[model samples]
Target: MDITIHRPGELTEPLRRAWHRAMDESPEYANPFLAPEFAIGIGRHRAGARVAILREEGEPVGFFPYERDALGVGRAIGLGLSDCQALVHRPGVTWDAQELLRACRLSIFEFDHLVEEQRPFAEHVTGLFASPVIDVKPGDGGYPEWLRGSYPGLAKTTLKKERRLGRDVGEVRFVFDERDPRMLRTLMRWKSAQYRRTGRMDRFARPWIVDVVDHLFHVREEHFTGVLSVLYAGDRPVAAHFGPRSSAVLAAWFTAYDPELRYYSPGLMMHLRTAEAAGRNGVTLVDLGRGDKEYKDWLKTRELRVGEGFAARPHPVAAGYRLWRRPVRGLRNTVLAHPRLRDPADRLLKTVGTLRTSHRADSDGAASGRR
Candidate 1:
């Protein structure tokens, strides 16, 4: 295999078409996060983003998108944001992991959501995770009928709640495809608040992440689209979601709801509505991503196994990087794997969050008094 590294923006039209063709040929590679457009979006904001193209007989055969730092430590492009990662290749094509890393000029390539079928990376994987997925089948009757049949209990209760929410609040409405950009901003704001309330890092705190989402919203192609779905009550937005979709797959990226309506379970409603709508819009599966959430367990028809690890070539930088990173990941994985451990960790985080919020409120009041 002949390898060539290029900035994602530098790829020619023929190379992009070849990348799409490779995805079309492999079911495992059919994710919008793995699409070339997504890489380009990241490359626009992230100077380190590059794609390593593999060629055989002078024809493009594979694509590996990654981000490398000055120290030679690399990560999958959109490392924390992308729910899928892989070296998308034609069927039966194979390559060495270390050789690919060398071609990309990397000492270590880190990933969290690598597809299980990528055998070349299998040896590098330290852990396997269950990424929940909802299999969407729009049969002769469509999503409504399928929902009733597949999850009668949930459908009955959720629909009743929807009715109650409408009667008590106002007309409850769900828009499968929302074109309004204002709603996108609303999602980020709510998500940012949610992060703070839960003692988590706010992704939207970064200007580049916000800009990247905005850029993706305008990307509409046959192979990839950024979809925004919203739920409302009497014109008041209560819940919203924004995610990327390929022709056959929709990844559940970001979803947020009004904190005031937590009792109504609007977040759950948003997901159910999105799944129903997504199936109708030519999406075959809704990837709920790698996490242990009750809602994911309640809704997923099945789960796909993903992996997290560092693929490295023997080097001081690679060894040092892994040594520093592995413990942090190990602690997180241990907590997630056991509810007994996860519960206490969650309580501690919530306490910290409560304290943080109150401190901010106090500071605001002090400033107001000064004014």
Candidate 2:
């Protein structure tokens, strides 16, 4: 096998077609995050983004997308944001993980949400986690009819609430695929605020991440599309979601709703509406991603197992990076797995956020008075 590395945007039209073909042949590799377009979008903002093309008999057979920093510590492309990670390849293609690391010129390759079919990297995986997904199926009566039949109580309650919302707010409506850029901006603002309130890193605060999202919104292709779906009460947007979708799969990414609408469970309503419309639009699966959220359990039809770990090439840099990072990851996973721990941690984070917000407000008021 021969390997060649290039910037994600450097993939030619022929290479792009090959990559799409590989995805078409394997269900596991059909995630939009693994598409060349997504990698290119990330590459536009991240200098380290690279794709390693694996070839046999001078024909491209696999694509491994990653980011390698100046120090050679590598990570899966769009690590924090991408819910699915893998070396997308045609069946029967295989390579040693160590050799691939060398080809990418990396000391370590870190991944989370890695598909379980990666045998070459199997030994390096430290833990496995359940990723909940909605298996969309079309019945004789379509998704809505089927969903009502399948999840009778859930469908009844949600629809009832949607009606109540309409009467209380305005005419509640749903959009499976919304193209307005203004609504996208609104989504980011809400998501940024949600992150702060939860004491999490605000991803939209990063310029590169913002650029990536903006770039991807314009990308429409056969194998991948960056979709923004919204739920609104009349003209006012209550909840919105932006994620990448392949021909058959949609990976749930950033989803946020107006905090004032939380009483109506607008976020959950957004998800259910998205799933119903997505299924109608030909998406067969919605990957809700790896989390222990209650709503995920309520909506998930099944679960897919993914992994997290580091694959290294026996370098000092690799060991040091792992030692520094592993403990933090372990602690997070422990908290997530136990509700007793997770609830307190969440409360503490919320308290910190509240105090921070108050302090900022007080400072602003004092400054205004002085002016």
Residue-wise C-alpha lDDT for candidate 1, range 1-371, written one tens digit per residue? 99999999999999999999999999999989999999999999999999999999999999999999998999999999999999999998989998999999999999999999989899999999999999986656754576687678798888788888899899988898898999999999999988888888899999999999999988899888999999999989999999999999999999999999888899989999898888878999999999999999999999999999999999999999999999999999999999999999998888888888899999999999999
Cα misplacement distance, residue 276 of candidate 1 (Å): 0.6
lDDT of 2 by residue, 1-371 (tens): 89999998899999999999999999999989889999999999889999999999999999999999999999999999888999999988878999999999999999998999999999999999999999986566854576697678788878788888999889988888899999999999999988888888889999889989988888888788889999989888999999999999998999999999898999988898888888888999999999999989999999999999999998999999999999999999999999999999999998888887788789999999999
Backbone atom clashes (below 3 Å) for every candidate:
0, 0
Which candidate wins on lDDT?
A: 1
Q: What value of lDDT does candidate 2 attain over all alpha carbons? A: 0.91
Q: Give the TM-score of candidate 1.
A: 0.98
My TM-score estimates for the predictions, one after another, are: 0.98, 0.97
lDDT of each: 0.93, 0.91
Tell me which residue pairs clash in candidate 2: none
lDDT of 2 at 313: 92
